[model samples]
Structure formats: C-alpha cells, structure tokens
Target: MTVCEMCGKETEVFSAIIEGSELTVCAACGRFGKMLRKPVMRVVKKQAVEKAPGPVETVVTGFASLIRSAREKAGLTQKDFAMSLNEKESIVQKLENGAFVPPISLAKKLEKLLKIKLVEFEQEDEVSNEKRGSGPLTIGDILNVKK
Candidate 1:
C-alpha cells in the first residue's frame, strides 16, 4: 500500500497520464487518464573507458527564407512539401516562417529534399571579421602588448 497522489489516501497506486501529466494514482483517480502498463526495468554493464566529446556543429541563419525559396523553386506548395517530407503541414509552415528550427534529423531530410545547405561546421582556428578590421595592426597588436 502507498499514498494516493490526488486524494492522499493510503492505498495501492498505478501510473496514469492525466491532463498531459504522468502520476501515480489510485484506481478511482485513474479514471482521469488512460491506465498505463507498469514499466520493465533491466540492468546493463558499462564500458571501462569513456570517449571525449566531439566538436559542435551549428545551423546556418536565413534558413527560413532559404526553405521558402527552395520550395517555391521546386514548384511545390506547403502541403505538397509536407507530404514529400512526411511531416505535418504546420511544421513546414513554422519552418518556413522562422518560428522554429527543425532538429538535426529533420534538417537532414530538408537538405536531401531541397538540396540546400542548412548546417555548417564551426572552426575554432578561424579568424573573425572583427579581428581583420581592427584598425591596421602593428607588431605590438599582434604580440598583445600595451601601446
């Protein structure tokens, strides 16, 4: 016997998803959500060695405009594009309107379907525009010394 989540009565509890929330409730309260089956637990062994993380990749800006243009160029409507990508039309609308950025998997699908570059790699050794236009560099500027 355990505590009832909603009524606070001491009794057995079952897992249920009520109003988009998962809770442990009694049979009476379980009516609020669909009854969920008990989850199974399994144990596994881990490797002795751990690998280091890899470099981060980033999505390019102006993706919304690019997507819209590509879709238009392909002579496909939003509904047609969604059907081609196997995604919802609303998702296509949101992606085209810049309301959201698709996950990596979805981005890959877009790249394949539209033939446009959406993701770019970040280079740590790259020099930025700010460094290039820092008002005519001198030896001291290169060596980081006080003028």
Candidate 2:
C-alpha cells in the first residue's frame, strides 16, 4: 500500500500518475487529482478592441468624402456600389464614413467605376486663371534676352 501526499490517504493501487510519480489516492482524492489535471487546447481566444484615431484620420476623411460623393453622383447606394466591387457593404460604408483606410487597388477600381478622378490636385479653375494671367513669351524671353 502507498499513501497520497495530498489527502493523507492509503490505497491498494495508484489512481493518478503525473511526471513519473504515482499517487495512491482514495475516491475523494481521485476527484481532486482530476481537478488538478490541465486541459488540452489547441487554440486560445483573444479579444481585441479597435484602436483610437490619430493624425491619419484627416487623410482618410478626405478620401472617404471623395468616395461618397462619387458613389452618390453615380446614383448608386452603398450596397449597390459594394456589390459592383465584389466587396462587403460594410466596407463601403466604413470608407464612406471615414472609419477605415482603403487600399490602392480599391481606389483604382473606384476611379474606373465612377469615371471620376480621385487624385488630389490644385483646383482646375485656379490653375487655369494663373495660366491666363501669364502672357505668352518666346524662346528669347526664357533666355532672358530681347530679340
């Protein structure tokens, strides 16, 4: 007969074996042994929360507004636009609402679908006005010499 160190019980046979050691335990002690055994798990779940917004939010805002305006002008709802792009409606909504940054591929697809350029540039009218005010000059003007 052997004794269980945990419950101070003696038994005819060892009820639990751990790390090359046998435990002689009564029925009540055996229940305690089962409790001590570790459970086998392949994966453990972890919870994640969304990160807080930062400086990039401003840039995303401009992109989101551009996408929203283009979609609206094209007469498509968020669901309709997302379906056309083979993407989730939530993704379109998030982009429209400035909740997420869109990948370049998505932006290019949007530009093609909407037929509107989304690139950032100086206002066309402002640029044209500047060009108009600048009088025509010859090659001599560029060389800083009068013909």
Candidate 3:
C-alpha cells in the first residue's frame, strides 16, 4: 500500500488528488486543503489543536542563530541577504535578534535565497527521541503545520 505524503495514511494508488504541481494527497488531506482554501467564516471547528505557550524563546533564538550562521557561511552580510529577499536590512537584523517571526512563505523564500535548510526543531527532536520502530522521517513530517 502506498502512503499519503501529507497525512501518513495508507491508500491505494488511484485514491489521491493532485494538488499543485507536487502533491498527490489522500482524500482527507485533500479535504483539508479545501478547508484551508475556504473563507474563515464558513469553517467549523478544526481538528488541529493549538499548543499552549508558543515556541520557546530559546527556540526563536536558535532559529535566529541558524539564519545568521547560514548567511555568514554563504559569505553574505545581513544587508545583502535582506536585499536578496527583497526585505529591509532592519527586518533582517530584527529576525537575527529574535524580535520577529517570519511567515512560512517568507521562510521558504529565505531558504531558497540563502540555500539553507531551516527545519522545525521539535520535529527533529521527536525523530531523534524515538528509540525504535520509528520509520524514516520525511521532510513533510518536519514541516507539518502543527497548530
């Protein structure tokens, strides 16, 4: 049986919906996509639960540090990197100082512009924490939108 890349559910080959140019998601995640696309007012309760106490300050600090390290490794100053993202230098400075949280679209743009992989730390930790019987983790797992 083939597995749905988005939700990790098993499915037969013909039972998936193509989304964009990349994803072939199962029916549930396809419905999820539809829900996401709909206007906010029309939606009922969502399945995902928001975790209390958003990411710790340390995690934000670490993300900023990773951005700085990647930029430095690429031999680009904050100004140059910001210019590449069509963003302001001050914004880049703020991000490096953990004073801002970038949107996922911006994060993807930065990853492409800087040629760096910035993954979600909690997911990484969970994968490492599993001692046995855990299947190989995919990029989708690391980037899943956890509310």
* Top candidate, metric lDDT: 1
Residue-level lDDT for 3 in candidate 2: 59
In angstroms, give how far residue 30 of model 1 lies from its true place: 26
Whole-model lDDT for model 3 versus the true structure? 0.64
Candidate 1 per-residue lDDT, tens place, 34-73, comes to 8895433346889678434445566788999999999999
Q: How displaced is residue 123 in candidate 3, in Å?
A: 8.7
How does each model score on lDDT?
Answer: 0.82, 0.64, 0.64
Which lDDT tens digits does candidate 2 get at residues 1-147?
555566776654344654455555555656644433422324777888844433221122387888888899889999999999999999999988888777767776777898766543332111223324367744544342326
Worst 10 residues of 2 by lDDT: 122-131
Candidate 1 TM-score over all chains jointly: 0.50
If both were scored by TM-score, which would come out higher, candidate 1 or candidate 2?
A: 1
Q: Would you list the clashing residue pairs of candidate 3?
A: none
Candidate 3: 10-residue stretch with minimal lDDT: 33-42
Off by over 4 Å in 2: 1-61, 119-147
What are the candidates' C-alpha RMSDs? 14.0, 21.2, 17.9
RMSD to the native, candidate 1? 14.0
